[model samples]
Target chain A: MVESVEGHRLKLLEYEAKEYFRRHGIPTPQGRMVTTPREARDYTAELGKPVVIKVQLPVGGRGKAGGVRFADTPEEAAEAADALLGMRIKGLTVEKLYVEEKLSIVNEIYLGVTVDRRNKAYVVLASSEGGMDIEEVAAKTPERIVRHLVDPINGLRSYHANLVAKRLGYGGRKMLQFAAVIESLCELALEMDAELTEINPLAEVGDGFTAADARLNVDNNALFRHRELEERLLESYRGELTEREMEAKSQGLTYVELDGNIGIIGNGAGLTMATLDTVMLQGGRAANFLDLGGGATPERIGEAAKFVLGDERTRALFVNVLGGITRCDHAAEGIVAARRELGVEKPIVVRMMGTNEEEGRKILNEAGVETLGSMEEAAKLAVKLAEAS
Target chain B: MTRFIDKDTRVLVQGITGSQGAFHTRLMREYGTRVVAGTVPGRGGQTIEGLPVYDTVVEAKESHGVDASIIFVPAPYALDAALESVEEGIDPVVVITEGMPVRDSVELMARARLSGTTVVGPNTPGLIKAGECKMGIMPAQVFKKGEVGVISRSGTLFYEIAAHITRVGLGQSTCVGLGGDPVVGLDYVNVLRWFEEDPETEAVALIGEIGGDAEERAAAFIGDGGFTKPVAAYVAGRAAVPGKRMGHAGAIIQGSSGTAESKMNALRDAGVDVGELPGQVAESLKELL
Candidate 1:
């Protein structure tokens, strides 16, 4: 039940992932993004062939949700677009459709490069089995999947790529083509600082291969280095990141909106998440998850408080500060200040400890705000307050 | 008997002129850590808190014989700072900076592995030997000298649980934060092995959040008799939804992997006592001891 939804990475949608693929010399189906049925029909008519209309959402199971449809005629493409445009899948509205020229696929193969956290390296996974979940393939028939751990220093070398291609049962010129796609994917992953770069079902169409589906998850910390790509991919689509989430990002805070009434704020990521979990265990739901990071000053704490309190759904606020690098007094000041400034009679419960704990408690107590000693106790009281409110 | 850091460990601070670097350096020194030197790139030949600031880790190592280096450089420059220390053959290069690119962390870990240098974190509160030395940004007040070796993925949760342990008249021997990022230098297995070797550590308390298979791996290690010490654990993120990054880059339940339930079950199956809450962690460890 750990329900925080803080997406730090830039997860590019299907169309955007393919754009990177085309840029990296990997073959993909020619596609156009359309928001309306007219645009979909126009794009399909221009292609002069059957097209696949796929709704652009960050979530999976789009096919199961009927977000994917194939149309031979432009009229049918328009109808498919009309059905999908305003529909919701996995809580995300289908604002756009990706129409691609249907390709004659002979075979499907999986190729990807992702960060192996345990190994602390980029692992390239290739399999003859594709067009299905790779996890399923790995779990059910792992022997079919060939995994190669790329040396972080050496990167994905030519030998590594060739070895993976050979394992996937490709040889001669076909192996070379497969190897080339693997090289490009590795290159793209490195250049973008991507956590994951995947091509599912690398369709074999007569002469060569084409990426039928692609996913690129750029590292959040490397977003500064990829500002241009970030603006192009993230800012344009604004895929999973909401308005408040974006605003919180700008404020140097990690915030995720949940459907509960208690706004939860803590200094560190794990503690904040634990705060949310504790609230849940106490039979209360957290309205949001916010980590104030380390060494939060009074100003930053106030800013975070204001941001969390800005939500109309946040009926009560729970501030849990263990105060390692973060001073408990600063957190207390922020809570008192935000409550005073907001002037909304929302109940606030704080549990402050560690550095300057007594001072912090005094500040909150002087402000007539309730303060608890234990995180579980504070969470219980906050939940009780939220339910009462 | 102490692990990672002791009172005699010669420490150096990178990015010493920065606010966080300078602040933590003083605190580390105040807690009896021998913070010998600092590196501030262009701010070489300057002095911060009575310690000479060298332009490079090579110079600092030559001058101060620095054993460990704590990095406080910003995310963009963390890779360069960490590499400099690793190349200089500094053991246990502690990276306190958060949000370091996973690519950078991988490269750092790779280089560290080749050099036989132990890298603590790219996003961590660092490690401390209770009542002896402190190398991270954690407040020195919460910990006291005792026999429990504490390891955690989160900085504040480490403190919260450590304080609880201390409150119950138990203290930590060496508390190490494995960092809260997906790709980190040290994992639970590495720390568990070290704690197993530490003579003073009677029991272990592990604070794990939902992310990665680090805990599961630790459980496997303990189950395999790689570590025979009594262990108690508390895993957070019981309420985490799949596909959502829970604050920490590493603290996400991706698909069916990295779940709290899975981690807890693994530890419980390994004869380790698993606690439901953070407070229960110390209590469970107390019972195990």
Candidate 2:
């Protein structure tokens, strides 16, 4: 099982995220993202006093982490915007500030939609009281939070939506509107194909409706058909690239191009990562982590291995793989195929398992690729190879 | 005879103009997969590696009776390319394109539901019935026709399982790549079901990881007596750090319960002899049979 979530952290910009929520009919405070601090002053004035000034980063836990702040005055807002505008938090450069008009927020509550890991279904989480330090909210009043898992097929029914609102002490015809928003959010979460979405301080300002302080993380997996949503994700990348990394990226190869001797060829993003970790831990740094990816045939492996070996920093090569759907023997064949075509001038460490292990070993051994046992052993050998190089 | 795919299954290659598309399409032909047509819009009627190219999946399918397809389109074009195959009435689409955002996969998969078309992967290695048809980029030379059936989410783990099986003189009847995408069409349960009904397949080898209740659901199906066939499950990520997921979106196990340990426990509880080492799966299967 190759389990990985790549391209996380970089998220849709605030203007886009809010627009997405607003387009989905989910209530969010009216907001604008400004490029310059001058626009920040204008948006703050337009939003009036008591507005939230957030850095508009993609990562979660930002509010508690102080990536988000509220400004009581336009002057305070401009200063806040300046502080966050160019601030780099967790590799994401904060480029814009989301200055939104704050709502009355009588009863701040926490509501979220996430894929419940245990049940393998979409779940709806609601709390009567919202916001004030998420940690404190979860700790001080755990009982207020109501959770419901929705069957992806059946979806979140009206009663299920009402159940959350009723638990939150909402009722009457006004309760229906609350249900509508909750239902809308849940529907939108599923409709938009989100991984998780949180509306902390889903407020109860007026009797009938409330606004949502929306934080929606659409599942990147479902972005294909959602042209608008897909566009939002393009905004997620940092887009900052070093010259070499950009050159590698152009070829669709994720080449970190570290100052190391061993070039690792593997499949599965996680395995590739583990390979990197192993190599680093074993007193060796990797030139690059090349996941030929699953279904990497001998030819593709051959090509990837050649490319990895071609790097000037590469003095040795580490090929680690566990053939799940893609066979290791084929990868081994690719190694031999590539080496024969390109010639292996450097020592290669091979640790391969899964489908056709014997054949894989045989092919590599015949080609003179030294096969190791475990990933740790492979790393140790790689370290040894690097030192020798 | 194989159920889902066999030697005679007519095929089409999407993105046939690209190097990846052109190369893999040739391999499909060499492996005895009857690749009748290919698609690379504006490169219509041209031949790449000697296979006829078309403008779209619709035209290719209409002209060639293509039932199974292997797509080599880039990530950006992968969704529409896969969907075009689906729209053209193809079943069992094997999408080899990686980096397709998760959302595109979900949309394509949901659309597959509407048409009853099964998409193998947006990020996956396609399925193959050993000694017969090859769907994705499976290395045909390593595979041998035998009774042990295999299914996996990651293409590479299939190699380990096959290697172990081969060491014991066992070979695969059918190897299905259910794919790594979270929203892929076939899952553990689907392939397991096919293995259960396949006459030639004696024992089934399930290669799985954490995340997605695919493993647990397969366990439920097995526990409910849906699978009379013996199952041996080998799950990866034991060496993986607590929070670290492997590749493939569905492979991630968030929260406490989605760990590989939990998945292994669930499978064992359902009577699957889950293996820890790469070679142990074949050993467990030998005991069961």
Backbone clash total for model 2 is: 44
Off by over 4 Å in 1: A1-7, A34-48, A71-96, A232-247, B1-3
Instruction: For model 2 chain A, give the 10-residue run with minimal summed lDDT.
Output: A1-10
Q: Which predicted model would earn the best DockQ? A: 1
- Judge candidate 1 at residue B211 and give its lDDT: 75
DockQ scores for all the models shown?
0.60, 0.17
lDDT of 1 by residue, A1-389 (tens): 11111245677889989988999999898899999999999999999999999998887778999999999999999999999999988667889899999989999998888888888888888888888778788778888888888898878888888889998888998889999999999999888888878898899888989999988888878988987775654453254667777788677788877778999999898888889989999999999889898888898999899988889999899999997778889999988888888887888999988889899999999999898889989999999999999
Docking class of 1: medium
C-alpha positional error of residue A336 in candidate 1 after TM-score superposition, expressed in Å: 1.1
For candidate 2, the chain B TM-score comes to 0.95
